[model samples]
Target: MSATSDAYRIEPVTPAVKDYLRLRQQAGLSPFSEEAATRGLAGSIFGVSLMQGAEIVGMGRIIGDGGCFYQVTDIAVLPEHQGRGLGKRIMSALADYMQAHLPATAYVSLIADVPANRLYQQFGFVETAPRSLGMAMKIGAPESL
Candidate 1:
């Protein structure tokens, strides 16, 4: 498919639990339990779903305190739908939301996977290495302790 394909459109809506799990798995991201996903989604500040007809082929979300902090997370696209600029479409919608709703000093950040870091850069995200680093630990996982 071409970058400008009209076959897909980005919608400003949170993806349903099923679509959220499916897309994350299909896109090779970490798995989250249904219960965890459901609880997490309810806290979204803003989200976008890339749709084709009635199917969600991609999705992204922003979550955090309304005025002081925000995180860009869950950016995923179905493996079959990758490489068609759909990710860009999702990010564009998200960026627009952040620009419009987030306070001036609100800090926004994302822990991007290697190659996808390039994509995040296009939306004004910079690597905060040298001085600070991105880190994470899955709850209940041994490594987290």
Candidate 2:
């Protein structure tokens, strides 16, 4: 198959739950158990898949309370398919969805790893540091939650 970025078609569909998990694992993101993945994906507000002839080459998802909070997560493209601008394609779809669907008072956010964070800036995502920092804790861990 051609490795060109434009070769893939981005579709508005929930990817298979297993594909979602595998893509994340392949992309070096944290793993989610089968039950957790199933439940989490079931609650996604919207998702997009970059398809190469019925195969999910890439994917992204939006999750959160529909009205007030939304997060862009699980942005993953297969390693063999990386660097063809698929990440931008994924975020573009998500940004369009937010513009059309989100309430004006709603907050949209993402925790971008370095370098990937630069791509997100084009979509107007600003860092939330120096005023209020982003923080998190694993559930049930001894550390403060």
Candidate 3:
């Protein structure tokens, strides 16, 4: 489909508890269902998904402590469906969710991956300077049922 003629249906994925787990793995991101099942988790997560008919094409989420900080996370579009600005749409949806619920003074952040970092930059995200840096510690690999 040509850029001028293609129109995609963008919405948060629903009734997709399983497909959600599969797509996240496809994007090389880990699933958090076991953690999510716990009744009172410490963080808040707002998820948005992009779909085409019955298939989930992309997804993103915001996770944080609900008060002082938030992070834009898990943004992904399948390999065959990328280059069409779907990731941007997902981010915008998550951004809108954030704007509606986040405190004015709350800190919003994310860790960008490779070329995708360029996309986040368009939304006024700047690299934190010498005082701060992105870091992480991986746990056990994802276990499937």
The most accurate candidate by lDDT is 1
Between candidates 1 and 3, which one is better according to lDDT?
1
- The collision pairs in model 2 are none
In model 1, the Cα lDDT at residue 86 comes to 84
Overall lDDT per candidate, in order of appearance: 0.91, 0.89, 0.71
Off by over 4 Å in 2: 140-145
Candidate 1: worst-modelled 10 consecutive residues by lDDT: 1-10
**Candidate 1, TM-score vs. the true structure?**
0.94
Candidate 1 lDDT score at position 121: 94
Error of 1 at 5 (Å): 2.3
Question: Global lDDT for candidate 1?
Answer: 0.91
lDDT of 1 by residue, 1-145 (tens): 3444489998899999999999999998988999999999999999999998888989999999898989999999987788888888999999999998889999999988889999999999999989899878788895733
Candidate 3: tens digits of C-alpha lDDT, residues 28-82: 7765674452321224367766877667777776777879988887687777777
| Model 1: lDDT of residue 35 | 100
Model 2 lDDT on a 0 to 1 scale: 0.89
> lDDT per residue, candidate 2, 70-133, as tens digits?
9999999988999888899999999999999999999999888899999999999999889978
